[model samples]
Target: MAQTNNATLIRREIITRLCRLFAEGRLEDIDRIALAMAPRNAQTNGSRCCIHKARAIIKYRIMALLGFNVADETDELESLYSYALRALAGTDRGEGVLTVVGEACTSCVKSNYVVSNLCRGCLASNCMVSCPKNAIVMENGQAKIDSLKCVGCGLCKEACPYHAIIYVPIPCEESCPVKAISQNSEGIEQIDYTKCIHCGRCMMACPFGAIMYKSHLISILHQMMKADKPVVAMLAPAVCGQFRASYGQLVTALGKLGFADIFEVAQGAELTARHEAEELGHVLATGQQFMATSCCPAWVELTEKHLTQLKPFVSETWTPMRYTAGLVRDKYPDAVVVFIGPCVAKQAEALKYPGVDYVMTFEELGSLMIARGIDLQVFEVEEQGAVIPERQFAASSGVLNSVAAYYSGEQIKPLVISGLHKKNMAVLRRLATGKHDWNMIEVMACEGGCLSGPGGVSSPDVARKLFNAQSGVHTEMLVQ
Candidate 1:
């Protein structure tokens, strides 16, 4: 789920820089960010057409960072300081979690298979023979593709012996499982929210870093800074693998950042799994074929928007985030609950949960730590041997394992959909139509589970290694 790229780094740099200003009590200086970022006669230059264009993109990026939707901009003359004021006034949040930064969009073309210059124009003419649409033609000693007739099936690309034909893809469009994003008439990408699953795949896939989410960072920061109410942080279990910190150290870090309390969502996962197990038992007793986990908000959104028929098969149990948020509400009743976890989907999900007031990503949390100069390496807790059930919630098929513990029926037959690509989605569609032996399906939007979510900080490989080695071993005892 993680592709190491400079675009993602640039976004994080902007987040951290803005957070630094907030921490320094200099929110009025927000307008100076873009200018400072792209100064005149810089030592090195970026890949933009001009330094001014780069700064314009950064300004839009800052607007998103300030919790404003770039798409809602009616005035080209609006200043960053104005947006910052609106954010502190608590009116900057957008309609949805995501928006396209047109200034930053590269306007990628529709994916097509093109015959490159490497074509041999061989006498065999396999490309012509394999073209289902007859869209391939040899012209002037090179193979040419009829773009008008080409359906992008890539048959010619595969049939050519020399591999002269290549398929160019729009990463965001291809990454979206629901086909919710597409190019407009101007070739700028826009999202169809009616079909979007809020997976953040398009946001993560866009190479130009045009697709961005309306951040709650400023709002949450204001709440923490105000300290009017208990500002609690509900952490996901995947946090153990992020920040290079042990569980105890993360709790310490949260407190250092002015969190009034910390609550482990894993603690709530136990209740989720138990309730889901009971529901599964009831569903099976009533002769249902299968049931899917509903913890992944993106997965739930997918079924709700695209696979309406499969919605009945999804479990009705509360998500760990919801249950944990409910627990905080039960205790404080008026606390400003902020969920800190690894996925962008949670930001949208939190709006409906009532218990959660805002959401922050692991990426943003890392930036927040950097802004506050809180290093994970500094806080070390004395190790103990007590096992924690909630810690297992981070890994793949973790929910299935948890449910299997509470399930009293026959041994659970599980299907793990690690990533929601087209091929994997076809499998889910097939299951909805036909009978399947598997009883429980665990669908994680991110391939390696929550640790590799769109809001993740580390690479999937690195996260898996760290999570596997550290799970069930670290936690703040009171909170976890």
Candidate 2:
């Protein structure tokens, strides 16, 4: 009873903060102030300290109301708040995300035991005959199991051929690509966090909904409300496909949130197209045959981990996300910048730059709307900026194809690399050995770029195809 009372109190506090930030229109301000308060860290270069603290206070209030155990709840709440702040600022990253993934992965198994009732007095003992490890035996005309001798191997199931054996897959074990999941003696699944890549595949695979993410919308809303500074939003192109609402309406909605202006990361891509053209000219002048794009953070991380050699080949230009923030800072030096997108990787990118102050995902943005009692459908529609025909580059090889379109006289060929793991490894090798030639290259981490990131709201392939088609048809209409 006491615990229930406490839980209610904490939940109320969280909701209350949400309301205050929205009502006061200070979400962005709070973010800037919190960031200003965070002491510079020699290691991370002083990111989001004030925002982190504000989030902690909220989480503590919630834990208290929820009747969470003081000791365990305190530790978990600290980590959750930290993650929440990171999400708001957009620098929440690999190791931390992996820890959440690990805990969630461990919570999915219903049970570990499977029995075969096919045992018969037949002397042939087919089940025993098929046991490679000799784990099964016959006793009292029935099979008595010796689990110690069993390896949980499904061979006995296969041998029974009678179809009496069952398989109970552990969630973590099923989702792991590196095969790093295993069971403890008590049947709980354990994840090797060190081997986990924070891909978030396990979180999607868990049927029990144990894997969860800390939402940072409340703190971010507070920061936005409190700051007196100019605030501009950089919207990722993948966002074009995320909501049921039209792209133009979403921009108008964000405008209502107090962002002074909205710029497409695709516009930054237009700049990237121009920049890559210049870089290609330099590569040609220098007789350097290989150069890679540096747009995708996940691909970048993968390259750092498994293809260190390819770092040299990556383009020195800032990614569209970073460059867009740079453009905002250059134009509005007093602006508190935020990146609103579909990626957790973008969160890490925001922390690395001085210009971008926060990273909020689509989901967190939705949370902010809910916290504020703002129904997106009810917002008055405002005129959207013209849908630029050249902006599709924000989507897929949209970058590479756009670059190709810019060159009229010269028949310059360019290479395109897509997908996170494969392209990074390939580009790393090309850069290291200087083996490939192309005037320019485009690389998106997911199979179809941002459309397929782990943080996406729909099926990756379906989302990518949909956006690509939408952009294609939109461009075609303009051309006609």
Candidate 3:
């Protein structure tokens, strides 16, 4: 297995250096900076892969320049252009650095939304009136704040007759299931990193693109290029939806990027279907009323921390991505598995689970492809057979459909769960306490399933259209 901790440290060290370089105004030395940071060339180096390292370094550097504070308008082009001009100097031109830089440019600072521009200077003063304690005050024809006495009860923001008093929320904090995000004196969203489950929905909700996750693309790529580790690419089902291009074209592009083979996470979905079906049988046999699918990492993590009572109900099968990585590694002992999809939760998933070495979202892959100037439309590439997803595949009911296809007996009734938010909490509560009677359950954290994940590219509708087009090819029997 690759030493993930060591690789992460290397990434941090390089970013720290680049930060210092920027501060020194040696802007012209960007090429030297890229060369210095590139994954060590495999020919002369011991373990460094220049492409992978360059990708990691560039991403962190761009995040740093964006101030990493949650706020909107962080999606501006200057941040990307600046990083690109700096990273693509001389020898390191056309490297994976742009993947990092471009992604950073697209990220937003997820903030706790504070109200802006909609306040009413009303006479009834319902906002102040609603407060049990006098926390709100009106001054200069506007609502003024006094944090000392006011509890964050939110009554003033909620009770305002005009809906004018707005509550600004921190991006990540707002996205957290538990109210873990609290403001420090400085008004920055202070993360209880310990309390955080690493779900990364905040990274998605943030308009300013401030939040970031560590990258290990360089380390994995280096291993593939130098170690010749029979690297396999396991693409998630949501991938079909993210790209505007044909799915075949995207697979061909990955082949060109030097991946040894591409496997659909949908293949693993088949594995999940088989395993979960078996588990569901065992659950029913043992007189357990309902079994929940454990394949969705976000659902599992949330249930573990917040819905501990429901843990016993989750299915035991590994997720589609993990299942695929495990299957490939078993077949190819030297394989270094790279899972490409649209889930940030998968990054956290890789850290906890074995088999998977790296997780790159479609967003990241798009950046990588663009950085290399590989145009999907014009590339003369070979078509690999289409890979279809089986389990909790796309958005709503995707998993339910797969489960139904695999199970033949007893007329099973399965609950399809999506949108793991406060509103969806009631359903889980019902399932755990026996308020609902279903044979099985399929849950997705995002409202529209994996395609709507924080790491997703393209829209839900676009991804669905692509996925539907590819569904007919899997008429053959399942892979053993």
Candidate 4:
């Protein structure tokens, strides 16, 4: 519950309800049962104006969970039961990784600046004088913002001595690093997939829970329930610190959830570390500029879509998830490899790699555990004999450390790009212009690396400590 956000809780409830219906073989009755249980009564209103409207929103959420495109106009008039039947029939998968529940979007004001009641109408007129765009004006003894002239530079807010000026950012727009989210003509938020990196930051930032991602939970569950072949669970390094239970217990729980085998993605990270280190060494030896790590799918996408100049310099190494899935495929040719991690971008990344059969976030996996009634605390820990990779790979500088450890004899001049913010773009621009001095660069789109991933279970602070402790346990082994 510590990691549970309002959005995460809502998603969990929807998934849990779907799983219950699936277990009871009552998927046909999902719409009626979910609506009844969601609002409980006419008095049980949620974020919407009434319980009925709230239930309507929930219906779309259930549709997204079933892999249906919530934004598809063709299904605009369809019922939730219809979508459920399609999902059960295994025919309709969503067209995109992200979608907006237009009904849930509150249509907040588009302006980023607002004149607050705290404006004292001071005679000094510091706010007025500081406005580079002359966006601030005084009327009726109160400060006002001229939306037409306001460029959102925030100079007026900074200059106001009374701190009366307030910056009211649209959460989704502000959180999106690439400015992919914008308001449609109807005032509903729409994502431009061309610019979107599938990072899920906008989804996490929206307070109204308006944004959501298409889930493959039902598809994965169907495969799990069938049990025709092996289903391998590939856990990311961030998994070490996700839950209250120990890692061993979590592995045992996966088995109980019908996974035929478990593999640590950290093993793949170890392989990536060596591969990246060697690649970096070769690049440096050949007198090429610095090489950026390509482990983060979002960062890779950001370069491909926006920073086209930097794409060629990005390391060609596969991410740990993909590399691990490849190994899983080599061993079990017909196995379903599910990559479980904190990354939402991996959902999109999985689509590009045939080795990966499915991708589920830590939040989604938590819901699956709840729906299956698998209590991690009570599960007996199974002895896992696999080689656990360096846990530092879960945090920002971990990749640098991993690659440095791999090339211990060389002096690896490293640059770390902790997050994809507006300021960090300047660095990438500099790198593109051949202005940087480093031999290797580590870039993670999410601040503090994968532990701060949008789909992460624990907060970055807590996850960092847990990941550090785990890293220390096998430090010597990792170096070897």
Candidate 5:
């Protein structure tokens, strides 16, 4: 996964500012967000062409945050305040998971390996010699590439002495693992929902801030403000590493945000592990070759959409979120359950289960904290329950370890898929052919697991360190 860049920071700022406006009871001024961020004659960020362009981009982003997909808008003159009114009213709007801002898209050139200006036209001509297609040649004191003959094999790029040969890629297109993103008739980027796994790679990859996921912030906030019924937060294990405070302090922060109660999803993770272990034992005993973990909704959706052959191999056990949502419903039947996690797939997953009413990313939660002026450092840490083994489920191998702690039927051989890139996906296809010897497989769509999800607020490495400090457990160990 790529590091956090200026694009992400800008989105975070907008979210925080919008939430602050709502918290301050000045939502009537919502349309002024763009003007406030980019006043007339104000110096624009170096990224855009001018202040007006920057403001248009900002307006589209706000539109998405207000649960309105910019692509669905027929009126170019629609005001941000109008969208705000519709969002708060929760009427006459379709809930879209993802949307693209065509105005913001730079429409990156077709992906190719080209010779750059830095080419020194070295005497040895390593680039020319290394080109299998003989597509590179010396001209005008710089190496030139023959577009028709170039195959994009990157051999010349590696052979260049001055590193002048470069491969320029369409940011959103290249980041997608399943080839779900492509260019439309006008050359603007478009997503194929039929092929997209909703792994959220494109949203995080776009340097131009063109792609966005519609948010349910206004709907969730409205329920909290009414205060007629319980509003419970189902916090995921990844929350342990998102903030600078202890788990208890994070719980207190949620309470201040009008949560009547907070339940740990890890509590449900423990039950999921136990049930999955039993299912795995039964599968192996019944002569099935292996079983795949079904915790990652993206991976599960990948099977349903792209990898149909692997669907049967996936365990039927419900995810921690589902189990947790069920628990909340059984306890408080009238409560509105909001799942808080570092996941984009959770939004799609929540739609399948009625127990969960909404899903909020940790980035969104952080913005709410900033908006409401809730400082985590000063809040007294609420006393927490005993930490369980399942608390380590935030990391990549933690799921397998938790299952290993419970499975006693047979000695297990584990295969862990830490990230779901193109190459790893091919391996999964081969696995479904019943040729592999591994008895158990665990997959996380993001590289380092839920901690590195697109919605994560902190880096996976830092998140792992903080989580480890609290649990004092070796979460990376796999089954024998």
Candidate 6:
């Protein structure tokens, strides 16, 4: 099977290895196996100065998989093997959802402007002329930018007709929507937990695979292995097109993995739509300016943490995952409900809801399946009695469509905020200032909705194609 990207491939490889170890009951051997993962005796290291350094990086990755934060200062004296043993014993669980692998961080240059080889030493010197800071100077017929004086306005690059100036951004810093990621004194990237929304953009952005989240896989596997209580799998709508197998086949596969029941989060989305519509009607009756959807946890966190003024306008209804977990708990009171979805923000969101015992991403689910050697093709497709949700729910316009269905006769002016990036932040700020005409705003922190989530198995375009093809077959069988 073709991999999506290097980051996903590396993440999958680590998860797969950890799953294998857990399956084989080899927790005691993590130190030996993890150190031996890279070619320690090779003449040249694959990614570092020496094999030992490479092994160190692998150890940190292993620690992350075992549910330990690689950046935690308290764990500075602990060994990877010790962490593995603790995970196996089910003694210690990590404190944070995300961490930076300090050893793996490359400490990329902070300068945004660089003189590329494309510079032809043009006589006009448009770059120097356009630079407002006087940071750009002609040196030996080449444009030289003083890092100290440059303000990263990009005017010099924009003015140059040759496109000689290249902007070298710090990937993690640039990808962070809330400016939560920054370089420490030693130049290693650090995440401010208070400001972070756990979107996992930095994890995807870092080319060196420095940023990672502590996986709940081991805890989940332990729950299954114990079989003390029923374990239920709550799947997101994005799961529709994630696997090559049909929904029924995937359902059967989850049963084999020891899940007592499977619940579709989209079913909860249906409930959310009803609640939100009523809430919007109430808000409108009260003459409130506008309201934003609170289904996306990252967007909610963005409002609560950074955009305080917007908090009053956010919906009070629970997210699909939280609502679904509640339904599962009602059905099986003692069951440990595990939410399997595409968004990494769900990991942080799950913490707020006690009903949700664990949160695993689609990428993690794929790795778990691969590690367990569960072949979806061999599992015969059967009737799952699953509810097919609004197809738009998995994409950008789904929320608006669902809510609009409830208020059919009303003139509802809705705005869709696709992906919460820097530009979108400005728009949200304007909306918070009560300067917009929109009555409703549907915000998706990930572009193309949940399908393009950070933990998604396939690209949004491919996932959408697969989802549309399957929707026709499932639509007729849908309960509502």
Work out the TM-score per prediction.
0.92, 0.64, 0.72, 0.88, 0.90, 0.88
lDDT tens readout by residue for model 4, 194-304: 899988888878988888888888878888878898889999888776776667888888888889999888888888999988888888778887788989999999999
lDDT of each residue in 322-385, candidate 3, tens digit only = 8888778878877888988767667668878888977776665765565455789885535545
Q: What TM-score does candidate 1 reach?
A: 0.92
Q: Which stretches of candidate 2 lie over 4 Å from their true place?
A: 1-95, 98-199, 213-215, 284-289, 373-385, 407-442, 458-480
lDDT of 2 by residue, 303-376 (tens): 56556666666777677777787788788988877788767656556655677776766655554555556665
* Candidate 3: C-alpha RMSD after superposition: 11.1
Candidate 4 least-lDDT 10 residues: 471-480
- The lowest-lDDT stretch of 10 consecutive residues in candidate 5 is 471-480
Q: What is the C-alpha lDDT of each candidate?
A: 0.84, 0.55, 0.61, 0.80, 0.84, 0.80
lDDT of 5 by residue, 267-312 (tens): 8999999999999999999999899999998899999998888899
Indicate which candidate wins on TM-score.
1
Superposition error at 349 for model 4 (Å): 1.1
Worst 10 residues of 3 by lDDT: 90-99
lDDT against true structure, model 5 = 0.84
Candidate 5 Cα errors over 4 Å, as ranges: 1-3, 92-96, 115-165, 382-385, 471-474, 477-480
Task: Please give the RMSD to the true structure for each candidate, in Å.
Answer: 3.8, 11.1, 11.1, 3.6, 3.4, 3.9
Model 1: colliding residue pairs: none
Residue 419, candidate 4: Cα error in Å is: 2.0
TM-score preference between candidates 2 and 6, better one: 6
Clashes of each: 0, 37, 33, 0, 0, 1
| Backbone clashes in model 6, listed as residue pairs | 392-398
Off by over 4 Å in 4: 1-3, 40-46, 88-92, 118-165, 382-387, 408-410, 469-480
